[model samples]
Target: MDKKRIILNIVVVCLILFSLYILQNLLMPKYVSAIVEGSLIEEYYNEKADYNHDIIFIGDCEVYESFSPISLWKNYGITSYIRGSAQQLIWQSYYLLEETLKYETPEIVVFNVLAMQYNEPQKEAYNRLTLDGMRMSASKIRAVKASMMEDERLIDYIFPILRYHSRWNELTSEDFKYVFKKDKLFHNGYYMRVDVKPVTSIPRGRKLANYQFGDTAYLYLDKITKLCKDNGIELVLVKVPSIYPVWYDQWEQQIEDYASKNDLLYINFLELIDEVGIDYSKDTYDAGLHMNLTGAEKLSLYLGDVLTKTYDLTDKRTNKEYQEIWQEKIDFYEQMKAQQYYELEKYGYLKSFGAKAPED
Candidate 1:
């Protein structure tokens, strides 16, 4: 064979290999879906194009686990969605909201403040930044334009691959499926039930001496607060309930002071733990760190009531489209609840096969 013929054959083989790789990705399961699962904000904006809601909750897993959009719909007729990330920091929350506002204008924006205290730089934050950049659309460009820093935004927009390069090896066939199969993506906008055991002592002693807010997070928080105020949106900062041991600390006071100084509505559930009916011994999902499904349900109901009474949040569940969406969410929640019960029973945590109680 001549040189040119050999080159052509090699090119053809390369193309065929690439095609096979793409096909495999499309046919796999979705184990790595959690990574992009948090990217639902981008997906929601991209898919729906034009959307609006009365309330939008943004934060880390606490937001997803604690706030049930379906519960909001069922109780208050509020059409809402949770734009939360796993271990999301303040910077990520700001960008997520910035991206979201491009397609939707929510009347109320609630931020879960648990992760706000986290000052350490995490790889996940960078990964999320890159994903958002990769998923940027015309809407995203406009959102970024309205943002504060051009250089930082450009860093993420241009080099998303660099941020998540470490995740390449972590990707499995399931992750490929999650990316290729649109249906496999979490559309219900809720999280699964997580069981927590009780702890005798709250892990303490580790403290960051000079934990100052990064310019990115601080700037975004100020901008976000102003953006909401300018648009007549109510911005509420809520510290979700965790077990007593984990929740108590000097930092709690610091957070409360910050919220008060800003004139922001800060709801610290720590004081109302008894009022919220949280039995750390039984309500926590993972000892004293977080709440389980049982805990989440109790918190959700409490939040729904608090939001209804505090804000003029209008319920949009009467709309046929919202009603249909909410029904699907309810079904998904039931399935997740059943699975949690099964796990709890299997572990011998419960006697009657009901919800798992937080163990000590």
Candidate 2:
């Protein structure tokens, strides 16, 4: 009777653990529908085993929406991934870089500079979108500590169900379908938008008493440089040509100065817009804030040339193994592009293709 009771207790514990795992899986955001940026970070884990890319882009929405790895591969044979999110702050980027180094070390790390303007944590929602997907690691723990708003607790990140259990009422069919798995929504972390929203009015940067980046921002920037140097990875700083939230002359000068001082390469795409052949009227999807597929491809082509020539990155287009992988990516890219065009034609705007604003 004692042995039987002990066996029953062991079974009960296993069952309880399994049930909690299922519940945690179900409660977490699927990120299949409205807010898909949340899905980007986790997607990296899925690809980690399959390939070791040559380049890794670390930044915010600008990097994901602006750079097309598919295009880069096709046009220049460069393999890359973007670990990006909405409003990804400086410290968050630093932690993310640290976490990424645990997986594979790439030859180059391209960091977007817009995030430098924000020295502190932003919002809990944005933090979750970026950090929740990161696998449990020392880097993730540091990211959670650095990114959490005052109202958030670290325990909530450790046990996500504690934070998302309230989502029981919000669960949809997607929750059940994607409970254990999710569809890949990005091409090597590039969020594609084929629809075009022409630039009308660009927002001017607000007048600031001090245009200098905060000390905290500089601290992480220095950390990023040092970390890359230690790893023998080239750190290339870039300011994507997002016309809004204006990239000021002061900011440009500061980044330029820092790059010169550190002997690092800094490329501001805003200065190369015309040279890159980006047409503002069609290149941007949500006005000039982010690029559409066309813009990304164009930019990727230009950057691919730079990487190939400057860094001497090999052209792997002829490699059979890489060809096999990229062929699937190419097919998916074309299919997505065609689908977006179809949706645009049918509804006069993209329906499920991450439209900035739904058409009336």
Candidate 3:
């Protein structure tokens, strides 16, 4: 074949391969290899047909682990969804909300307050990964404002590929499945057991972490808060429980102070440990920050009750579809409880690891 014909054949072959890859992604069952969190993107795209939630929770893993939208549905008949990541910062959050606003508008927005610590004058490579994977608006103005003094901010928010380029190679078939699971995904939210340990002593001293509130962080926070206020939405700041002695000592007072100044209702569960029934030794998942399934459930129950009382959220459980969704979550919780109990008992490491055996 002549050179032109040869080049044309190669081009045709490449286009065919690209088409096949796209088709594979669209046809594969979700739960194969796609990252679990990417499912949120999938859900967002399909939300117009399936979703009708009254509340939306956004932030990092703290929001995912702490808030159980399913529990809210079960107890108060409110439907909600969590659009959070493992390490989402405020700038990404602003864009995430911006993108979400395109599809749905809930009555309330619960932003996990942990993003406050992500305040940096400049954006880092980490911020880019979140920005790319979540697909936030790459506005130069927003990026400049977010990174006040840091040059890295613009690239991180605009070109997230710089941060998550490695993820391309690490993508496995299972990640594809997770991303495109064919099964109907429900907004079951997270659930964990409550720690029943009694409060023995209070830690001393209150020192804040060197969490620098950069102009960008505050600007986005103010913008988010104002957006909520303008839309007639209620904004709540929540500090999910943690076992780090220093985390509690350093952040408790500072967060409380921020909440007071912003006129936001700050629910510091660290201060209400007794009320929340948190057993640091038992409820913590990593013996550090964040809670496990058991801990998530307990906190969900408490927070669900608190939210019900504080907000005028409506209940949608009467609908047949919602009932089906709640039933699925109930079954999932039952399986989780059984699995956790089995693991705890079989290892004999539960007690040593601070997990108390369930009392009969």
Candidate 4:
């Protein structure tokens, strides 16, 4: 071919590739300003793990919103991270745990038992919120396959631009600002809420024809249990004390039986509300659906005692390296705490840090 023709072709190809890249970037959702739970998984990759975590918590909002890793560090000297998202499913939690072990195997793995109620994929939105942040790998591929709803397409996940192409017209300033990067929104995967919305009443769970957890749920539970055993990672199963959605006696019995069978520690925090010092009136941000900062810290303190006492875990408080690393987290935690209080005082509600405010 002629020199001019070859040069023209190269320029055209470069233009096409660059255009695709920009279009893809513009079309993607920026979870920074809203629905910030979507950013939790991706944030872990961005985290500088100067010190390894002793515990890795995996589950849905229950695990992320109900526990404070900073509280664990500050009070118990226990290093931990929660790899959780909105409505994270059993298989997704399993895959997240599998992927997490590839990075650093914690001394203990805490799997929130709440996800056990879901036998299959619940919502595509939840799936996206949980799966979109994951870096591509075999685990991600399996999770995508396992978690995809009937209407969802696999190709859309492979190239998110295809799924989000319609988002072009709905683009906000957040989409552009965070197109290449995101702001730090969490402290070691713990979503913080300083505001309080006390629980007024506790409702009983409606009776069902069947209380047996589905085969798929049990299947993944077994997988999670075996995975922990094979890796020499102690797995602690806990039913986070979220006061809404009645956890049935039958469900409790099943998990208790499974824990007993596997020789694992299972603590139903719902039963120990008074011991944990969780005052639903002041500890929860959204009534009883989730805990706020005070509740989380209270629960963390109790659990930290249990973990430190039961296991041969390290107290990294005296380690200078850990002190330096955690000091940065502590600084961010205090700053965000102040910002949340400021927003609450000015707006009568939290205006930033992921939750809704007065206007936006």
2 or 3, greater by TM-score:
2
Candidates ranked, most accurate by TM-score first: 2, 4, 1, 3
Model 4: CA > 4 A from native: 1-15, 357-360
Against the reference, the lDDT scores of all candidates come to 0.63, 0.91, 0.61, 0.91
Candidate 2: where are CA atoms >4 Å away? Answer: 1-4, 48-50, 356-360
Writing each residue's lDDT as its tens digit, candidate 4 over 1-360 gives 999999999999999988888888788887887788889999999888855689999999999988899999999899999999999999999999999989988999999998888898889999999888999889999999999999998888888889999988899888888878889999999999899888988887888999999999999989999999999999999998997777889999999999999999998999999999889899999889999999999989999999999999888899898899999999999999999999989888887666666455
What is the TM-score of candidate 2? 0.97
Per-residue CA lDDT of candidate 2, range 89-196, in tens?
Answer: 989899999999988899999999999899888889999999999999999999999888888999999999999999999899989999999998999899998888
Cα RMSD, model 3: 6.7
lDDT of 1: 0.63
The sequence of per-residue lDDT tens digits that candidate 3 reaches over residues 34-149 is 23443443354444336646777777767776767666666778777776765667876776766666667777778877677656633343443344344344443463355444
Please state the error at residue 37 of candidate 4 in Å: 1.1
- Model 2 worst lDDT run, 10 consecutive residues: 351-360
Indicate the residue-level lDDT of 59 in model 4: 93
Off by over 4 Å in 1: 1-51, 118-120, 124-134, 137-172, 182-188, 194-196, 205-208, 211-216, 243-250, 343-360
